[model samples]
Target: MSFRKILVANRGEIATRVVRTARALGYRTVAVYSDADAQAPHARLADEAVCIGPPPAAQSYLSIPALLDAARRTGADAVHPGYGFLSERADFAAACAEAGLVFIGPPASAIEAMGDKAGAKRRMLAAGVPCAPGYLGSDDDSDERLLAEAERLGYPLLVKAVAGGGGRGMRLVHGTHELAGAIAGARREAESAFGDGRLMLERLIEHGRHIEIQVFADAHGHAVHLGERDCTAQRRRQKVIEEAPSPVVSAAMRERMGADAVAAALAVGYVGAGTVEFIVDAGLTHYFLEMNTRLQVEHPVTECITGFDLVEWQLRVAAGEPLSAWLPNGQADIRFSGHAIEARLYAEDPYDGFKPQTGRILHWQPAHATQAGRAPGAAASSVRIDDGIAEGGSVTPWYDAMVAKLIVHGRDRADAVRRLVAAIEDSPLLGVANNGRFLRDLLQHPDFAAARLTTTRLDEWAAAGAPLLQRPAPDDACWLAAAALAARGDVPTSAPAGLRPASVAWQTIALQCGSDTRRWRVRLAGDLVEFDGGPSVQLLGQEGHRWRLAIDGVTRELVALRHAGGWHLAHQGAGFVFTEPSAAPDQRRQADPGRAHAPVAGVVAQVLVKPGDAVSAGQPLVCVEAMKMEMWLNAQAGGTVRAVHIREREAVSAGALVVELDIDTVSTVI
Candidate 1:
């Protein structure tokens, strides 16, 4: 049955992607969102939108009943799972089928078969597909039995949870001494995440490349492979960068892996778009890693290289159409064109252990860079950006922090990397912490350029003490000056005529970022402003409400507006509050000093301090679990804990104070 309307049961870029594809196929798309994503790009672009619940996934995206109700309300004939949440849940797929709606993915049986890693391995082995030698039997309680299995598998084994994917619930054991701890840790994590702590052992391939083959199938038993992707660049087993037509895979090896992947899909009687992941060792020995019975986030690179919409194909396949009918099977038909690379631009700080960042996307605009054949000889390279946010959108700390996916396509890998760098260098994202600079650095690195990488490369790079490329000194000074001038509403139309007397002019500017404050004094001389104890700045020009300032060698523009008792300075994609010196007394008294509050609403997994415990600045005081992700709350200042108001596993609201520290003691430490 052809679907006339589809409901995307997801959020962020993936939901946006499903809507775009569905629209192109002449199908109306319905988007379901939470309160946090009311203004998201997906909601704005969908033909119809409905608010399912609040910001939390449990109350919204992961709420099966809410999604089903939305689909029914919108008259959606099909529901696209979009990779995460209930994407691989057999019950969700079965429910959709029972509700007379297409799931737009693999069958319920296929999802169930691949959902259990151990079961999939057993199936793969029986089907003659290359499988990693490991323990998958029902008997797993005996320590001696596990030890014997580990010895047979050799040292450096991976203990993986049967019901886990993504890098969660897995532990690596290098020796027998660490085997039990690794197993226990993996079991604990698995139980906490999937509610099933069942684990299996496998021989670890120390320098293996993560390769995955895309497979498409129809209900009529016809299936074909759409080449391969290299997702070796990762951190904690989560992919960071992905590319199509892996640089490491030879044409012959590609054919072998592709055929094996197709075979694996057929073994499960799979249908629609799916991925068969594998780990290829240094010696080119490939082992099956489980299959993902849904669309992948990195599907864009494959589409770019193949010039085929996988989503469109998925829709057609779901309608019982065969693959060969769309594109005839021939040498020219199966060829991949150009190279495409995608970088997941997340709101995260790589310098701080890849901590997720959350705040408002005050300003956001893609770089105008253009490649040779991609966009002619444009001033800069043009990047294809898939994002779920717009300017002035709030990135709540409720979900994943990925702001966008920046993709670049070129005639070759080298060209793609160069274009990607140019695009990142030109992007205008401020206020929130982003890894654009780090992505650029990775693309230009010797190992990445040479394609000699593994999943652990990112962690290794971080351990090597690589410093992030800081914004040029000139640029920093320019932005600071622009912010100062913009705060005063004294934007000049042109460069200042000359210097003025410093004795008669004293401009006080107070800038507030988050809870931190900075005070500055500026002595104006004609159009030039000399900041006391800081760099000298010259007003260049003004355009509309923005003021251009030149300081130290770089030029920056800022927008100014008066709000409350402070001047709001908006620049480089961020918003800052600048207040006059005279208003400091009232502002200080009004500032909320309610201790450090929870950044997000989640269950307090652990409380690290007691009422009388002494803690140092930057020490972690609490750990919160939200959406299956763990985040630690750190102390901003050293002090004795005057009060402990929360307990382990307690549910807390965002901005709720969990601990109260003695301000007097903290001040003394400072």
Candidate 2:
């Protein structure tokens, strides 16, 4: 390759992923980080790192000038816009070219052609590609004009951002009454997220499967599609899991879709990596969705099945290599191997509307075993974990909530699912509420196992109360293990002396969950730990965070960590936090039941309530924006606002009181 040094202009797993591959290919890599990510793993992994700007993406990662300056200072000859941030921004690509930097992506014109969803749909229709029935004309974007056209398009419409993807600035309108609101909300979100207030309307495919073809191209005008990735497993349009060699796609259908996808790439004169997304109905008919003009977050799955390092391909192509050079056999020789699945590990609470969470990672353990799953043509099964954070690293509110990408490959779909579930249970990402357990349960769901997933099915399943979300609770063994571990500390002089073992001190430990605490006296009993009035538990082995314990002769392996003044335990796919007892109970959580609280740390986007305003139950009192998500805090009960503690555009911590309501003296919080 001509380029010797490359700069990865993104964060999280995508950045690290690019860096690892580029470095392996003998290219020096530079990583750019914001102030908050000074200690991020991606930064440390790069040969050189640069501080671009502040935490917020607009002031840092999205700033083209800052990125180019970083590349210039680092003497980087190539720039890799890894997904999100400025990956699809045509201006960024153009600027890189202007600065004599090889943009390891499609040309600026290609990005512009495919970046706009409306424009891409128009071009696809002209190219004879099947497109969803919707409105993509630029006749007008006024509320009245959109409403009139939407009326013609009919109900259950999808409002999508014209400039970007990832379900941002997208909303589903099921009725005419919601069309105007959806338009406004989508426009505002689009403007905030992509700096574009434009939108397009699409007919909602409620029972459709989301499939995207991974396409690659070269300067020689040759392109090929890397089959399809079944992204049907989604929640609220956000992909939760993605797999390759879709369970539903037949060989004939794959061939047809692959041709169409390759045509879509060539239509835009695309070079480098891109994805052509499609929405397929139950009848096996597919419609063109928007195209992603840069690398995808779930590219690992396709790489695993194809045995191609896509980043390496992008690099070689950017350096003027043709398709024949990178692909020795070309498209005709392409092969799809074992099934590969990728599950996104996000720092979010699935039970609480999947709200984004922020915190320092107290403990980070990636699942790796001598036996897991193998890559294409590998000797044995192994696990793949692409993460950009480490222990003590913080998951801030300025970026995407995803902490890592856990990918696995197996001989078949069932084997992939089984290994992925065990992988999720084995990896522990503590100090932040996450969806690990929820993903495990989801993978185990019969509908998912049977390839019965659709775009709206996950949401429908949750709304119908299928109970996919179950909060973690400690069982007897876990409780005893936690107490016994906590008892290893010195006995406090303030407490009365209890029964003592020969060498190990007998101590009382209080393990608190929420407002309840389970205090127990534990003492060492040979190889077993005896609870004062409960059964004795024998700890067979204690490895790093993995403990093998036997209770009543029943053996179990649990992942536990005593960090950040608490015990983070995982048992049977459920995660629990049992904190040490505080000298005094927290008065904040005990006091205000009618207070509107921020669910996560974020900036106050808007304050809808005042000190004396009257609010009804569930009325939106404030809007908090965190990790690019706008969350509205609602009132818990009908009452008069007694006080407002936050202002618009001000930062607030998690559980910070935003507003107080004086309701009939009853306890309630939201």
Alpha-carbon RMSD of each model: 6.2, 4.0
lDDT string for model 1 (294-396, tens) is 9888887787777677788888888877777776663237668788888888787676667666776655656553211121211223367777778778776
Q: How would you encode candidate 2's per-residue C-alpha lDDT over 359-433 as one tens digit per residue?
A: 878767776743111223333444688888898888888888888888888889998999999888888787888
192 Cα displacement, candidate 2 (Å): 0.6
Task: Give the Cα lDDT of each candidate.
Answer: 0.76, 0.84
TM-score of 2: 0.92
> Least accurate stretch of 10 residues (summed lDDT) in model 1?
370-379
Looking at candidate 2, what is the lDDT of residue 588?
A: 56
Off by over 4 Å in 1: 137-155, 173-193, 330-332, 368-382, 468-602, 606-622, 626-628, 632-644, 647-670
